[model samples]
Structure formats: C-alpha cells, structure tokens
Target: MNQGTPRLAVLATAVVIGAAGLAGCATGPVDRRALCTGFDKLGSELMSANGLFDNAVFASAGDLADLADRYQGGGLSADATALERISDADATNGFELERATSGTAKVCGHPLGLGTTSYAETGSGSTQANGGYGSYGGYGYSPPTESVTSTAPEPPTSSSPTTPAGDEVSARATLQQQVDTDRTQVETLADKWVPQLSSKNHGLVAHGTTYDYRAIWADFTATRQAYPSALLLWSGDYTSYTKGDFWVTVANQSFPTGAAANAWCVAEHLDADHCFAKLVSHTHGPRGSTLPR
Candidate 1:
C-alpha cells in the first residue's frame, strides 16, 4: 500500500463533502419572492379553472387551503398573508339583500255627504158651537161644527256612515323605493371586494399600451426612473394577439428582502400610473437573458 493513498482518499472525501454542501445551499428554502410568485400563480389558476374568484365559498375547494398551508410552511409570510386575505374575501360570497321596508305612510281620506228626514204639519182647522145659551127660546141657530186635518214632510236624519280615503298608490311607490335601495346595497357590496382580490392575485400586470417592440422597450426604459438599477429587457412579441401589435417588457429588480420588493412596487405605483410589478423566480435570469427555468 502507498503512503500517499490515504492522503488522496482524505482529499477526495473533502471534495465530495464540499460539493454536497454546495448542493444543499442550492436546494435550500426558496426566497419569499419565489414562494409568493408561486402562490399567486396558484390562486390565479384556481380562479381560472373553477371560477373561484367569483365569490366562491371557502368550502368549495380544499386545495386552496392546502396551498396556503404549504406557503406558510415555507416561511413565505407575505404569501401566506395575501392568501388568507384573498381567501377571506372570496369566502364573503354574494351579498344578502336586506328585507327591510319603509315606515307606514299616512292614508288620504275622501269627502262624504249625508241626508236627514223629519216631519212638519202643513195645515190646521178649528170648530165651534153655540148651545144652551139660548135656552128656551131661540134655538136660534146652532153654530155649525167644524173639522180639521194636517199633512207633514220628513226632516233630515241626525247621523250618517262615512268612508275613509285610500292610499294604495303612495304605499306601492314607497315599497318599490325600499326594494330598489336594498338591491343597490347588495350589488355594491358584491362589487367591492372580489375585483380587488383578483387584481391582487393577478401575475401579469399590463402597464402602458404597447403597439410594437419599440413601445414596449420605451415603457421598460421608463421603468428605470423608478427602479433605476433594474435589469430592463424585452419580454416577447405577440404578433398573433388579436389586440393588435403588442409586446411585453420585464424589469428585473433585485431586493435584499421580500418586504423591500413589495415596498419598491408600492413606491413605483405612487408616481406612475402605468407602472406595475410582478414576482418572478430568482433564477428567471433577466428578460431576454434566458427562458425562465
């Protein structure tokens, strides 16, 4: 046996250990950006495939919850937070219309007329007679006796039944107003959150309108004003797109931490109306540098 063989074996073992260590580093936990990117992509796919973004209930898909759990386990706290927020929004579902009604309205009354009756005498008569006064003699002449008769007309009555006015038209109008307001409230709530959630989870953000490669390149160059050190490159050509000539540009900006990347996006959004950001993998190289792995 050669004395140098032992030393060579030891060196070889060291080299193997060093190579293994490099491999371990390479395979370590992915960065938060990559995890968030994956999470966002997952959510988009779920929404596209199942219409999950359209107010899907939490129980509708168990896979959503599982993906969130996986992201959380990977130490992508931001990704987990976003997933939870979006899921909560998605679980809100449709708005429930209120069944309330407006207060009762006063009814209008109608006028009524009444009649009465009574009795009244119309004519009268009297009678007289001269009798014994003339005792003996003169039975002169007896006064003629007289008779009388009378006729009457009815008087007005004392009381009469009255009818109240109707208010059907006013009541119906009020109820209709209340129903419309309830419907509006429900629709407003429905519109509020779902669109915002979709926007948050969307991966490819379209900035300014791009007619050709030059336009796309120009837009990307403008991004340098916000992310000065970012790597600017053309994304690709879309000659077959139905929306006319269009292209995409990618700005590869590196940040030390996930929070910093988010902050950069926020800051850029504040000034530029057309500026948007998307999470990409660390190994994505730069746009045009190489196809993403």
Candidate 2:
C-alpha cells in the first residue's frame, strides 16, 4: 500500500463514525424535560388563543399541564395540533357571532300569559282553605280514586283467511306499481338533464349534476352550518388532515322534497349561481342520476 493510503482510510473511518453518532443522537429517546416544557408552552398558547380555560373542566393550569405531558408522552403531536385548531376555529366563530348580535337582540322579555304568579297564589289559598294542608304541614293532595267502568264483552269477530291473501296481493301490486313509476320517472329525468348539466362549473365530473353531487352536498352542508352532515358525506373515509388519514367527515341529512332541499342549500350558504335552487331527482343506483324531476 502507498504511504498516503492509510491516512485517507483512517480519515474516512472517522467521518463514518461521526455521521453515525449524529444520527443516533438525532433519533435517540426524547428528552422528557424538554418535551414537558414544549407541552406547557403549547397548552398556554392554546388556552390564550381559544379561552377554553374559562370552562371549569379546562380551568386548572395543572390539568392542562398534565394533558400536555400525556400527549407528548404518547407521541400524539399531530392530534394535539388538530385539537388546538378546532378549538381556535370555534372561538373565532363564537366571537364573530357575539359581535354581530351584541346589544341588538333580547330574549324572553314578555310576561308569560298562562299560569301567572297571581293565579298560583290564589289557587294555593283556595286549597289551604279547603283543609288541603296535612297535620305535618305538607300538602294533603291524595291520589285519585279508581273508577270501575265496565261493559259487556262482545263476541270475537273473525275474518276469512282470504281477506289476508287478498290484502297481500293488493299490497304487492301497489309496491310494484310504485317501483315501476319511480323507475320510469327516474329514467326520464336522467335522460333529460344528465347531458346538459354534466360539465357545469360545480366541480363535478359526471355526465350531469351527479358529477357535482359531492360538491353540492358539501356546499349545502357548509351553508346550513351542517358540519356533521358535511363530514358524514363529503369528508369521505379518511381519518383527518392531521391524523393518519387525509380528511375527516363532519355531517349528513336527506331532504324530503326538492324545495326543501333547495331551502337547505340556501340556508347552508351554497352559491346562488351554482343552480343549487334547482330540484333534481336522484335515482337509486351505484352512481345516482341527478336529473330534473
């Protein structure tokens, strides 16, 4: 070997060792003290940002500190961050609502018409005068006496077995008729509207309004402040943005009629330009048709 080769080998070995040491240090057990300190800081920031500490459950500083310790110990940093975000959003929304309604709204200002205090006082006096008070100074209201009202038992009435058979046939016929009618209406509506609204700017990619169904659902949910419903339908099957999953659902509900559905869409704050007010009949299938009914 050349005289300079040994020196180069030694330097290379040292470099490798140094890199390994740095990596080991980086991935080593976390410093409990530092973790606890970070958690305390995060808790303070969250409490100040959301004012959750005003509630008795969250008021104790020690309770927050303990929660921080537990979260850090469990390696739940992402969950902690998400909880903070939700709390902050709720606080911001509540603050805005309070500001908007302050000093302008009053509740329960009118006197209650029925069962007023004067009526109660007079009734109580009348009851007292009637010796309704017991010796123990308690009200002597007795349970009502049982009334024995009786009538002759009528003979048992029987219907022929044919009656039930006929009823079953009638019910089946009605159900079949309804199904056929619904199917025809669904097909007609689908054929009519599916081609026209398929590519509209509602973020749908289907053959018609069905393409924008999820977006429409989401918009309706958000407009109505139906977070739970939106979460249930559009949130999909994801854990959440911060958790292992990429998203979380928030809400879900079905409307009874087209007008009711439109009203809900409007209340939920969906865009008026999106043709949200239009009623579309939905068929029952893998990909339901959103056609005008």
Candidate 3:
C-alpha cells in the first residue's frame, strides 16, 4: 500500500464520489447534478488509478468497458470517450485523463470535483465525515503497513542466523505445497460462493487477494471483529481481473440496505475503499461484480 495515498478501494470510492468523470449520467451534456448521481455507479477502478498501469488499475478495465458499452451512443460522446480512456488507460498508457474528468466538470460550470463537498482522512482511517464513499469506517482489515506476497507472518531475523540452508529450503517447499493445496480448496469454495451470494442480492465486500481461505476468513471477519457469518470468495487462476490473485471478503451482516449497504458499512466504519457494496451475483471471477443498486 502506498503510504502517501489511501487504499485502492478508498481511492475508487473517492473517484466514484467526486472523480468528476461522468459515469452513467443522463444522456446529455455533463452537468453537476447528473455527474454526481452517475459517477458513483461506474468506473471506480479506473478512477482509483493514480496514473500508473498496475494490477489494481487494470483490474477495473472490464467493468469500465461494460459501463462504456452502456454509454456508447447516449449523447455523451465526451463522457464516453473519458470512460473509454479510463477503461483502456492501463493498456494504452492514457492515465492522464484530467481533461475528461475534473476538466470536464470545469466546462460543466463546476470547479470542484463532484459537488460542494470535501474529503479528509480521520485518525481512525475513515476518509471523510460527510456522506461520501470515504466515510465508511469498519472493524477488521488491518492491512500490513508493507505489502506482502505470502500469508506467513514475518518472524524476527537474528543478527546472525545459524539455521541450515537445507532445512530452510525444505520448510519453504512445504509452505508452497500448502499454498497450492489451499488455493485449490479456496478455488472450489469461491466457485460455490458466487452464485450463492448473488442469489441473496447484495453484500458489503472487503476485496483482497493472495491469502488462503482460512487466513482470509479470519482477517476479514472474526479476527478483526467483523461479522463471523460473512462468506469468503476467491478469484480462481483463470481471470483477466488483476493478475488473478484471489480473496474477496463479503460481510453477511444484516441490513435492509444503506447506500445499497453503505449505511451498514458506515455503522461498522467500513469505507468504500476498504469495503464497497457489491451485487455479489453471477458477475464472478477475481474482480467480483457490479455495485449494488
């Protein structure tokens, strides 16, 4: 995670809330009201991109493309172009899209991004105080201050290690074997979960990858004091979504609906970045599904 910036989920939420690029706005010139209403519904992943072509940014391409498809001939050619640019920004190196987003807002008679609001980081890690994507704070999700590829906790290193290299190699091999085995089990579980969760309609998802099922489950729920009944899903080996590293945490906590689950998230302090409302339906694979209505 970049210490300088919030998590990508938070970034996406920020983009959705105020990135200014028209998402599913009305079929006309990009206006503030229409943009505010429409931005949060699409292209969040692209909005989250910080001008770098990496896995997280690239992961949103498919979703953004779908949104673009919906807006192809909707009298928002500039908006459509912006969406297309953001959708393909990773592949075509078009990360500099201010003209179509915030710049467009300026043309639409608004200097601010989305509306007359602002975002700030709270000490508790919540992004904002107003009713925006950054406001949801939640339990659990103690993201490591540093990025990690494997599930193993870091053990303190000795100034001079006396352990045998052969022994260390054997241990690593065993760990890798466990990882492979765990991934298969997680794969099966993820396949089973997609349709099941989708059938329910909506869920608050804490998206992540790399950790195995047991670790992911504990981290997303019980360990951090989140809903224990939450379901865990993984992105299988095959998917164009963000290099296919798996694990998505869906809190099964009950709520009629708030921001399509945003209210529940706020109650738990789960922001759109750390957690977002998802349909949890047939839109499977590593990337998960569309935002809830």
Top candidate, metric TM-score: 3
104-207 per-residue lDDT for model 2 (tens digits) = 11111101110111112232121111111111111111111111122322221222221111132332233223223334333343312221111111222221
Q: Rate the local accuracy (lDDT) of all candidates.
A: 0.26, 0.27, 0.34
Q: What lDDT does candidate 1 reach at residue 79?
A: 31
Total clashes for model 3? 11
Question: What's the best-to-worst order under TM-score?
Answer: 3, 1, 2
Q: What shift in Å separates residue 109 of candidate 1 from its native position after superposition?
A: 70
Better of 2 and 3 by TM-score: 3
Per-model TM values vs. the true structure: 0.19, 0.19, 0.25
Candidate 3 lDDT tens digits, 9-116: 788888887745564343334323334323432223333333334565443433333333354223345544665665665352221232233322222222112222
Error of 1 at 64 (Å): 52
* Best candidate, lDDT: 3
Task: Using lDDT, rank the candidates from best to worst.
Answer: 3, 2, 1
Better of 2 and 3 by lDDT: 3
